[model samples]
Target: MRAGNVKRGVVGLVAGVVFAGLTTFSGASAETGGCGLVGTVGTPEIGVDDTNAGLETLPAAEIALPEQIYFRTSTESFNRRWSFAARDGRIYVKEAAAQGGWRSLPLPGCMEGRIAGVSADDDEVMAIDRDGWFFTMDHALSAPKDWNWSTRYGTPLWTGAGNTLPAGTLDWTWSVLSPNEDHVWRDTAGNDHPVGGAKVSHVFALVDGGCRIAYVDPWLPVDHSYELATPANGRFRAVKLSTSASTTLVVNRFGDLYTRLYDFDISGADKVFFRYSYEDQRGLREAPDMLSERVDSGTAAIQLPAPDWVRQPKVPGEITDRISVHKTGIGSDARELRIEGESGGRTGYWVKQLTDAAWRFVATDQPLAGTRLENTAADHSIDESIQPSPYSYAGRSAAGWTATVANFDISNTPTTLRVDVGNGERLDLILHMVDGLRQLPQQRGIGTQARRFDGTVEVPGDILGSLATQPDSIRQFVTSTLGGRRFTDTAVDVTVREFRIDGLSVTLGRS
Candidate 1:
């Protein structure tokens, strides 16, 4: 695109009150520089669908948005701060606060739990840690609803069954339970049954899909022979592995656990990895297999990876994919971006377009064409698709050539632009868009200046006609601000922590 005169939008946010002002022009400003375009257009009154012009070109400066999250006090768990979770349209979470007191609350819902993962509905969340245990107060615990319970911190009050763990296990402090999902996930060792009974090692949820419960072996099996005891009725099946996957799957007293899949061989290239965030010497090497294994005195605690679900390949879309939408970092089973082939049709890869915001999905026959640069009114987040076209500039309009650049012809749009950079420094850019496609020029504060080539002439009548016919089409407003001196993407790091204008970018609310 050729250099067209642009104006700054004069606007301000004072205590959230919107103030309208009349456009003021300087006699001298209208006579020089590149602001000469659209000079005569006085401040114009805009109609519905048009937002006030708020464009601004900030000076080269360092700017940062606060991602420092402020926490809300909780009535549950005694003011202990907790994190947030999202299920369906609702938020689910159990926070861990430092209030230093004990409080209680109902359990979180099943959206995030060992029983049922987040939503298969294609929704997604921010963090996933089977992280801590939570207790719920929302509904009185019955049969344990969906899996998440709220967090509760009692004084040094009851480190119940503390001796159960071999000194080094976690506080085993977090656990949550609601009606349909009730199971205590701990980082320590304990086997106190949720039903108020005793067994070996003492811990287990309705594992194996309510088919059986986990417990220690008779006489606490010396080598840690764990067992998945069958239900009284015995219609469903039970699952248990060698002491290898115990701590990875369940916590137990005496700091001990074993494999969830015993009798298995290591295959080539089939690596296994498990993660538990604990502060230690390298934070790598290995995590405590069972709570007791850390001290090396407990029964069989051979660390092993969990088993994978071995069902039929899904059709890329299903409710089983729900875990992704609710979990912060779990691979999704659903296909939000999937492309299908025609029956005996052209061969190409399938891609599913997730959301319509800064990201867009465009399809093509080539596996490469399936990806595109998506830009929209949502998430200002943009993806770096292709490197700057070094071959040639493809978005330029001729200065009165075949596809001529008429005085006011807005025929072509810019694909993107390379900002002018100086030295090794970078600059930052900010955008302030005005509402409504029309009423733009009037509200825009464009200072006029004489064109370097000519003094003046009758502006083409067709140019004014076109401006009037398609005012709204020019609705998008842009503002760019430079931070450092250079203009490199690696140099200019700007983070937009929040998109405050509610409803415009709907997904910003998620954690």
Candidate 2:
């Protein structure tokens, strides 16, 4: 995670909640609720319409206030009765009473300027301050008679579960919860079991513009388990993240939005294997194999529609800045997404339904025609190994012997061959595989019937003169290739067959 220059504030721990202009809603009245509890009831403050058009706009007078708000709803049964939103650094509580109106919740002095993000299930609300401090408020623990502000507010201690936040988590920009409850992992024996005997909720956050996740399991031990959740490509630096049961909405720094899906194939098995050791009398030992494998299916991140003018011809947009998703009751699938960003020097709000594939202007109700969004290409790599045989030459000549590379098999074509000798002496041969000798018959009676080819590289005259004078000098051979492809069995046998002295050839054993 990258560090930023943020104004850090100190948060004090207070024992009680502060009640200022707090309105109490009866449990019975809140129970007999209406449209607001399950989904958005009336017209939203900015984008969208009755027909569910994408990216529609409204006049300034008709535009609702509090343009920036973080509203969240959960699919949990106990928490499905209400929802919560954070705007202007203040937490607002809303329920079914009076057709679902929002009311400000009183905050203690310590929490007044600390809250940066808020999330709610039907039964409780959780908030994270700007400095990455976590706090939670439960309905049963706070207000039993009504769903209203309670005096009890603090971070959850998890009683005897022995779970705590990861150390050194100083600042996180944003946070959100997965809309669905946690599921159990299936074992190789076809048995389902929870991790640490408890189902867990995933809390994802942006730590210095990088995606990170932590497990929230109230009934289990969670220690030092916060992990990074960025994609393997490492191309997308997320500015915003909103998650559902199956899909997570990601907004990159370029203002392009993507829907990401995770596909994990987990398998585990227990097996017994034998190990051999010379020290043991029996010469073998039995060992247990605990096999565990986790594979990512590499699902492609699909880009969504953005403002028309922002994405022209073949280029991506850089205007989207904010995103909010709404999910229906009992179903953790995103139904609508509200996108707010700058377009043509003017800030605008755009709405996109999951069914619609394009963004439409809210005022005109006309779809924005533009090119489809594109994803970054995945990265690739290659590995190669080459081995060269040692050769020796002993002859009475001022000229050094010629070295030949013969009897080698290469899987891929190489562009250049590098040969390194001792004393800073080296030779590079540009390879032309098609022009080299191929399929020549091998020696008749030696091993199996086969064919062979040879490539020769001349040693420099200066290097040859130095080696001839110092016969005891160490000679080393190393070979490598240059190409963007894999090569296998690229080993060649090097032999000094002959030498040229005074423009006359002399065989290896000749004087």
Candidate 3:
């Protein structure tokens, strides 16, 4: 077998394992310039939602927030989310809860420009402004009074080497690439070399003029930067490839898209190498039949290019219309595969293995908009639907009354309530209450009889606004209906429900 073909075959296998979401990186060699990479896939957080202030003068920089952030010590826990953005000549860190609102960090005057490629983890955060300057912070806040901002390492534990571009580096930089960990760099008298040796993670400097798309990994030689053809007048702005797997999806400044099959070898314990399984640049739009017919009809989006091991079959009808696959969650333990579709005037979702060509139906009363095959030991998965109250709300009332509310929407329509009020008394009640809907009708004393209240009561505003207007309504209702049955505990538990799969949190014990 030809050496090139053999390398392709190996990479193809790795791609299959990555997209399959089945393998662990135990005993595998770690590649330099690849610390952020998970076992087969890095956390796939999409960043196509940032609003750009102006037109395409520079390449759009992208950054994704990690699933969780942890400090060195458990001094405090930040259950609330944190996000970073560059605007108005400053970098702002905003928490989900408006504790401090959006506050600016004390960025050194030198590192002032349009920020691109912002990445943060438990220990540190790194950002590169448009001018090719980088900044790092140990804590995600401004420098303290009389504190040294110049000495602050922009990226905690970052190998400060290779961060600053040499004098001959590009005059204007498009964006900075933020890898999960520091990349190892070798600068032999300004001639970059990836010569095989002990590799350390470090940053690569991209200049204005360059014709190479080089990365040291599974198969490429470390001696030189692999040169690739660029489109006419196309200046390289941003190049974000999937580090999670051996898949290559590159979008140029001209919006020209390309994909390649890349693979690496870590069999030589502590020594890793990478090569292109299929080195040919496969133009996605030109390559017909690479995806399902949905690709041509625009019904589906490409989530991940089919790995070589799981490429589309030549013959149709074998594996017909397939919805787009979406990568969800973070890290090895949190990664999930999901697919969504619309059929028969209803939206549906399915969970299928990366190796499985066919989609398996996910059973649900209402058609699910999407479903994620969570990476867990148990059969746990996240299901998405458009309908309000994807899951029934079951909680104990202040008086220890347990009930379940279904089809509930605090802002809109009424919901069906099944209440189980127990305290040496039994009252079975079914309620269909809506906004502004009042159930303060003539009440009956505690009895063994079953009664149902079906009426349109005005809840006025949203669940919070309406409830806030009448804070003691629940207690009042309970007391009035039960002839002065008062709540023993005055504290009310409030929980803010997060809808996003990755951001899902059910925090309790708040009054």
Candidate 4:
């Protein structure tokens, strides 16, 4: 993929991974008989893909005036999905699963010419004008013309005419509004003619994965083109989806549906990703507990699937460097885990929660040496193909113990040594802790105080008991002891002020 612009990265932490095609998306509904289904905080009033009642339900007959099709679930009872189309300055609602012509609402001053784009949920309806001013009306006979026009000063204009309208409603839902400029005109003979006719100029709705049309000339059934621009809602990937010129649609390296005809049946409800959900909670209307929220509902989870190493089984010695917990929703009770590391080899470590009873290994049986990496500060160039490497604990130690580990990097949780070993292996592991893993103190300090750690030691008898074992045993013993405590890279001055391994003093630093 060609690098367009660097975007923000989301962190996820999970074990199992699931992948499914993005089928249909629906906005949440409010209380019973309210504008819940159609009115989201930041979305357009649209319908979701209910495979039971697919897009084929939309009338195949071509519409005379400009129209946009979307879905809306009713709060009447069993949130029935209704196919809505804003056509010829009128809002038409029909059950997507059922047959019959669309039922038009009482347009009053809209049907003749006033309303350009409109969306409705249940009885609540919204309308836009040529100048981008907004107004709302309820179809309930009780409050006939309860028109509530917008008081906001932001005047939205034609899609490609250097002016912009609010991309979506404050309900966090998608919308379908026409531009101020007319792309279609009719002669006295009643023959519809396209203005600047080669291609059609269309309005765009920047959605989660890509962009879609909000408005297209009904007369011009030809290809609808668009330019790219950041929408008013800055959270979406498309900072902009405007037309480069007046009528030409620019195609990005990623082929979105903007280059095709603005057909909702074919494109589905292609609007902005609904930011409102049980977890994200940005909806204007209270979300009813209908179905479980979308899988991409949480902010902590990644939109895509996990990497190959995460899904595939581990191999012996093969270094499965670092595994990032990109997904959210980890239960609070899960304190200890056995994440498989490399496939096989004399490399691996264990993480035993001091509170937990048993010790478990992650990858190989042999303890792997950790590394002390120092980066040379230098400027780098951004490339299309390059991606930042995930954090890893696979490097060399200074003492030549073929193991590698880095201090804790929370963004990508690397493996940590947990179990204890009998020989010097465990000790050598503790030494790595001196680098980056420093546990923070609970008590508040006056300023940023560099902490000093002092812990008592007991040399094992196997290393010092016999002269024959002392030489080789001492070296091995130190390696294991230091390696085991390599949990933090804190500058710990491990001074032998009073060395007593099992209460025996070693004649080293006795000044």
Which candidate gets the maximum lDDT versus the true structure?
A: 2
What would the per-residue lDDT of candidate 3 be over residues 1-511, giving only the tens digit for each residue?
Answer: 0012222345455445444432222222222121121222111212222232221232223333222222100011121144455554555554534343444544444444445444433223445555433344432222222111211111111111113222333211111111121111111111111212111112222222432233222122221121122222123332222221222223222222233322222111111122111112233222122122122433122211112211221211111122222112221112122233333444444444333454454422343322222222222111121223333455555546555554433222223434455543333233322111111221221122222221222222243234334335443444444333211111111123311111111112211
Question: What C-alpha lDDT does candidate 1 achieve relative to the native structure?
Answer: 0.19
lDDT of 1 at 5: 13
Q: Which candidate achieves the best TM-score against the true structure?
A: 2
- The C-alpha TM-scores of every prediction are 0.15, 0.37, 0.26, 0.22
Error of 4 at 63 (Å): 5.9
For residues 443-462, could you state the per-residue lDDT of candidate 4 as single tens digits? 11111333232122323335
TM-score of structure candidate 4: 0.22
Clashes of each: 91, 8, 34, 86
Name the TM-score of candidate 2. Answer: 0.37
- Model 1 segments more than 4 A misplaced: 1-135, 138-151, 154-314, 317-511
Candidate 4 regions off by >4 Å? Answer: 1-81, 121-123, 139-511
Query: lDDT of all predictions, in order shown?
Result: 0.19, 0.30, 0.27, 0.25
Predictions ranked by TM-score, top down? 2, 3, 4, 1
Better of 2 and 4 by lDDT: 2
Model 2 segments more than 4 A misplaced? 1-90, 95-102, 107-114, 121-123, 139-157, 160-200, 208-224, 244-246, 261-318, 329-335, 342-348, 353-356, 360-511
Please estimate how well model 3 matches the true structure, expressed as its whole-model Cα lDDT. 0.27
